[model samples]
Target chain A: MTSSDLQEQLNIKALNLLQGDADKIEKLIEIQMENLDTRYCPLYEEVLDTQVYGFSKEVDFAIRAGLVSEPVGKQLISNLERNLSVLYEAMNNKTQAAE
Target chain B: MTSSDLQEQLNIKALNLLQGDADKIEKLIEIQMENLDTRYCPLYEEVLDTQVYGFSKEVDFAIRAGLVSEPVGKQLISNLERNLSVLYEAMNNKTQAAE
Candidate 1:
């Protein structure tokens, strides 16, 4: 593979690895949020919001910079959305548990 | 206050809150990495690397957009560096623990 191809491959691999880490972080945030006070919910949510925004921007940058293909970006985004939904459910569960 | 001032103030507040969240996430990643196999360390590190890069970009964007003062951006970046150092120490500790 050419150097450009190698870079694209690395970007794709990084995105996949990032997805896995995002899943793990989501689970960890859920568990931590459960034990913390309600006041911290907004804080945690803000962090996640910033992260999601950042990740989305990075995906777009990767596509525009020709570091990754459109399909790869789309798949990464899909995984991000799925992970976010899981996070939302975890947050809801924590709220229910607190009540 | 002018609308611009209000926006800058909000940005500063968000940066401060983000700093707090970064600290928490650093701790969480540290703890999680301790239990997980060594293979996962690079994955976690990539997520963090991406995050830090994203954050630095955001900070620069904020300054360029006049959403935050240069000093405010500097402080935020400084906080980021501190948190990252702590994270590095955690990673080092994890490696030592595994040895």
Candidate 2:
């Protein structure tokens, strides 16, 4: 296959990997929040925040480069934002509970 | 700082990390090539190829998004391409020596 075709395949593979990792991270965060251990809360928040930020940037970059379609990029960004919000709220609730 | 500034900072940071990692990976590959162990040659080539491809796409995306300047992107790409060529030559020589 041509380089462009290879890039397209890599782009799809990257998107899939990002989505799968996001799902796994969100589920892990949910479980951690339910358990609500103060010690691990910060670590969980850090992981979620870092991964969401990094992945969102990757999606944006892909869209800008025409590696992925705009609609697909938008959807990926929306999902990531949703997950981020959930993580933020969980962190906030934990903080309030601790106070 | 504005979001644009933040993105610029991230772009710089990412570029530095990529360059540093590329340097380290290249050094490792050189050492491995010197040793000429068939067992690890495949693994080293795989790492170098995958990283070069991924980082080149990232540089392209950053340029398209205006996150990095064109000259800077061009320099980065040139460096990566040079490293890749060196790796290819090393691998080819190894194959020839074995044959």
Candidate 3:
């Protein structure tokens, strides 16, 4: 697959992993796949639009949804938390510079 | 203060609370207030430029840095994880709808 396609798939995979109840989590996210499906699943599109960055949301979403092993999920969340802490500092530091 | 000033102040307060070592943490983040100060504190403004969203980053950054009480930090992180999970699902569902 092309890079964009791969990105789309990974994004989808990460997202699927983040949803509720891993055991029951479906590999195929049954959203409205097209114009024909939209009538049934409108919430799908509305939510994807929210711009939440970083790793914890991705990992936590997966763990709580039951898509990943709990340990792995926790690891990802921890890593993100640490990195973002630095980034948070960096961002604030940057803002200070800007002013 | 006007709402904008309040936002700027809260944002500053949150950023200050998120930095390292609470007991030793200073309330005033001493960034270069102007051209005169810029030579010394460049990292200050650089950090605030990154666009990280949600509560966990806000709270965890604070706790790990020793700026906040651990209990309060954990509670914020928990709430963010839960809410973000729902948002992740919703976003994926939205993407599915888009297709």
Q: Identify the superior model by TM-score, candidate 2 or candidate 3.
A: 2
Q: Give DockQ: model 2.
A: 0.04
Scored against the true structure, residue A98 in model 3 reaches a CA lDDT of: 59
**Number of clashes found in candidate 1:** 0
DockQ of each: 0.04, 0.04, 0.02
The docking quality of candidate 3, as DockQ, is 0.02
CA lDDT scores, all candidates in order: 0.61, 0.64, 0.40
lDDT (10s digit) by residue, model 2, range A1-99: 555555555566656755675687677767766676545546767666655655565665556544568898889768767766876777787789879
TM-score of each: 0.39, 0.43, 0.23
- Candidate 1 Cα outliers beyond 4 Å, as residue runs: A1-41, B1-99
* Candidate 1 structure quality by residue, lDDT tens digits, A15-98: 564466457556655665565554445577666666666656555544544445789778776776676677677677767997
Worst 10 residues of 3 chain B by lDDT: B21-30
| Runs of candidate 3 exceeding 4 Å displacement | A1-99, B1-58, B64-66
Q: Sorted on TM-score, highest at the top, how do the candidates line up? A: 2, 1, 3
The A-chain TM-scores of all the candidates are 0.62, 0.65, 0.35
Candidate 3, residues B8-48: lDDT per residue as tens digits? 44334544443332212121122222222224343433332
- Residue B5, candidate 1: Cα error in Å is 46
